[model samples]
Target: MTGKLRCAVVGTGHLGRWHADKYAALPDCELVGVVDVDQEAGRAVADKHNVPLYDDHLAIIGEVDAVSIAAPTSLHYRIARDFLSAGVHVLVEKPITTTLAEADELIELAARHGARLQVGHLERFNAALMDLDLQNQPPRFIECHRLAPFKPRATDVSVVLDLMIHDIDIILSLVDETPERIDAKGVPVLTGDTDIANARLQFPGGCVANVTASRVSMKMERKMRLFLPNGYVSVDFQNRVLTRHQPGEREMFPGIPEIVSEESVFEDGDALMAEIRDFVACIREGRRPLVDGQAGRRALATAIQISEQLSA
Candidate 1:
């Protein structure tokens, strides 16, 4: 922990390139290398950072202190396993893996090897959500809508995993309990996989969340609304705006209290960099990350359940 932590990025695709950018920009971290099946894509990122490019993730295992695994969802398990087993810290992207067993194995392996495993639930570091305390004012009902135009690059998976998983992680964190019932429906449009979906989750804690995700929409939107015991909150993830409605001391009527509204626009910032910084800090400080392997597993488990319901 005294010197800079040598880091490598696996799978130099869309998000993986940004991972390399942050690792190189951070003062306490050194961008050691990058990996990809497409050598041209991988070399572009590695060359930008002046680091070597490897054809396989395992090629850089022993040389790196940590790695950011942005490989394809199916390959997440294999690459993360080798790195964790070698005692190298890992910051893997969303969903952790395609199956619960794979996620569990990664969690267990990280523990056994004493290596830190963090998931790229990047929204956790959003400026708008930074000061929102979910524990103190737990929500009774939640609503989320995430929409994006169809892109062939991300059609490998359903919209549930590609987009909705972000809100799933956030909602699960706020509810802090397993859902007692899950009602879901989805259908394919542009691709064979589900392009639009909705899931209504009823938690054991008397909380309900209605989540929807669409990849065939004409316009992009990311928003969430929460109904609290004494107030309401609206988070515009796309614009980084947080709005709250609560009761004021003054009354609008003889027996009713007046409603007070407040809104704040947070600076649109780089959540990816913040996520990587936390990953490095967790490795150095010997603490669990905000979105550790267990947390990611929980989100993935719930997502898989929802996906199953859709298929049924």
Candidate 2:
């Protein structure tokens, strides 16, 4: 806890490579090694960062203080459990595990071992969202749409888990309440699982969130709008833009209230680095992560509920 923490990145694919890069760049941590089943891909990232590469995580598990698990969804639970059992802090990508039971087990394991478990809800670190003033005013109504052209990489899971879960995690964080009711519908398009899906969640305090996600869109779009008591806010996640609208004193027409709008753009912020830095800081300071295992579990549970409803 005094000197630099030794960290490793498991699974050096498209996203995992970035994790390795960030760790290498941070002065507070040392990039110990990289793990990937694909030797060529793993070696490429390891060589780029000047780190060692390993095919299996267990070989280097005890050598590192912490690890970033970017493996496939199915392997998340097992890999995370192994590291947590070894008393190593972990930062795993979203949808903590394939099932709620697995997520619960990991959470318990992390707690029993006194190791930090941070979920990679990357959007929680989005610069646009971080710039917004979302403190006192909770959103009463929320709408989210995440669309992307078909990609075979993440087709192993449904759109609900792959895409909608991001919005779900954000919404759950804002609402701070479990959904009382969930209604959903979806269909499989390109993959065996649901390619496009929609879900309406009703929270305990009359807050409602309507979410839609698709991997079969012509254009990519990631946006979320929130209707608060005093004003409205819209965020373009892809562009890192935030726009807010509130009632003005004067009206354009008699007896009508005019609207005032303001916009903020963040073009040069690195959310991934911020997220990883926070994980490292939490480990050093003994603080909880912004998005912990329980939060990820809640989002995954809700997503699974919606997926079940879609099937039913």
Candidate 3:
């Protein structure tokens, strides 16, 4: 915990390369190695960071204190299990794994081995949400939309797992209870799987969420609106802006309260770097992460419900 912690990044793809960059730049971590079955991709990242490169994750199991598993969703469970079994802390990418059973097994492995298991829900570290506190003020209704143009890189899963799950995770974090009812609809466009989908979730405590995600959209947007008891909150993820509207003392008309509005534009920052920094800090301090394996499993459970409903 005192000396620089040794760290490595597995699957040096697009996002994995970024993880390597952060570990190389962090003073508290020494970039131990980068791994990828694709020799060209892994070597590129490793040479760029001046670190060792490996084709398999097992080679660095005993050498690293922590690792970032940015491999494909299908391989998440296997890679994470191996690392956790070796007592190496892990930061696995979103959707946790292909199934809830896999997620549960990984979580149990981390506990059994006494290692930290964090999920890469990168949006949780966004600056736009830094001031928003949903703990004390739960919203009665929530609306979310995440849209992006078609990209072949992430077509391995449906839009529900690829995009919608981010918002699903955020909403689940806001409300501790799982949804009591789920209604969903989706269709296949470019990919054999559903490229666009929408789900309506009703929680046990009367909270409701309507979420829509599309990978075939013409434009990109990431936004969420919350209707609280005393105020309205809006988060523009693309622009990093948080806007709130609350009732004021001065009335605009008889029996009507004036609405005071405030908007905050956050500075452009790197959310991935913040996520990595937190992972390292949690490993050093021996504490639970913001998005632990349990949270990831919760998100995956809800997403699976929506996906199954859509297909049925």
Candidate 4:
């Protein structure tokens, strides 16, 4: 509500560094500080960005208007809970919390404190997905594949939460409905937890989404295909490309599968920056975030359901 939105980046590790950098670059945002459990990591990022660094995240909570929590998934509930309780708006990474109860608490806390709680479902901001017209063409069937080479960093959780949850968030947003049933299965390969997983979600509208996520893949691929009555859409998350194929338009080609394709290409842009900027703007304008706590909870709940089914 003042000259600039002073924001802090908590947990200055891999993703946190990107958050700090984006806040530093935004003219409307003031990078008040960076915090991490690892003091060296925090100080190094702050030094690079020329901002104050804190070893304890709470030290900067009162110093900034908002925060981006990029800490470990386990710490999300505590950190986000404390920040929101203190009336500091938060932009938390995906899988808002490890459990549905924790996610619910944060949602209520944000509302009670009158603070914004934004979830980092970054794919919603992807240019390709942004352009697709989801008017009356909600998919009856959705297929998603999110595969990546083993990275020791995010293996704390299963591939369902780490990777598949992204697609789950997108699908939930697109379907605009609640799931009626879910059946899932997975096996742990590289890690003690599930390294590859798949889920079939059944919604009330007869919509089904078949989602698969793997962290033990040979190469990386993030793609989704939506099948509708009149046309189909394919999105490549890695390349930010969208291809659409629709039915024939001309009378001469009536009843024929006349193919029309347009590749929606977006310039290689910084998604992290876009996410942070949107958070800062929300803080300044007091507007609800595009990915609010309820939105996050929807995705997290679906993921938990799938993970439970896998365990069974």
Candidate 4 global Cα RMSD: 1.6
Off by over 4 Å in 2: none
lDDT of 1 by residue, 137-183 (tens): 87999999999998887577799999999999999988889999999
Model 2 Cα lDDT, one tens digit per residue, 252-303:
7999789899999999979899899999999999999999999999999999
**Clashing residue pairs in candidate 4 (N, C-alpha, C atoms within 3 angstroms):** none
C-alpha RMSD of candidate 1:
1.1
Give TM per candidate: 0.98, 0.98, 0.98, 0.96
Model 1 poorest ten-residue lDDT run: 126-135
Assess the local accuracy of residue 85 in candidate 2 as a C-alpha lDDT between 0 and 100: 97
Better of 1 and 2 by lDDT: 2
Model 3 residue 285 lDDT score: 92
Instruction: Please provide, for model 4 over 1-312, each residue's C-alpha lDDT reduced to its tens digit, 9 standing for 90 to 100.
Output: 878888898888889898888888888788888887788888899899888878788788778888999999999999999999999999999989999999999999999999999999998888788778855987989999999999999778988889999999999999988889988989999888999988888999988999999999999899999998778899988899999878667543656666777788887756677777787777778898889999999999889888888887
- Measured with C-alpha atoms, the lDDT of residue 232 in candidate 3 is 92
What is candidate 4's CA lDDT for residue 242? 90
**lDDT value, candidate 3, whole model:** 0.93
lDDT of 2 at 27: 87
Ranking by lDDT: 2, 3, 1, 4
Alpha carbon deviation, residue 159, candidate 4 (Å): 0.6
What is the clash count of model 4? 0
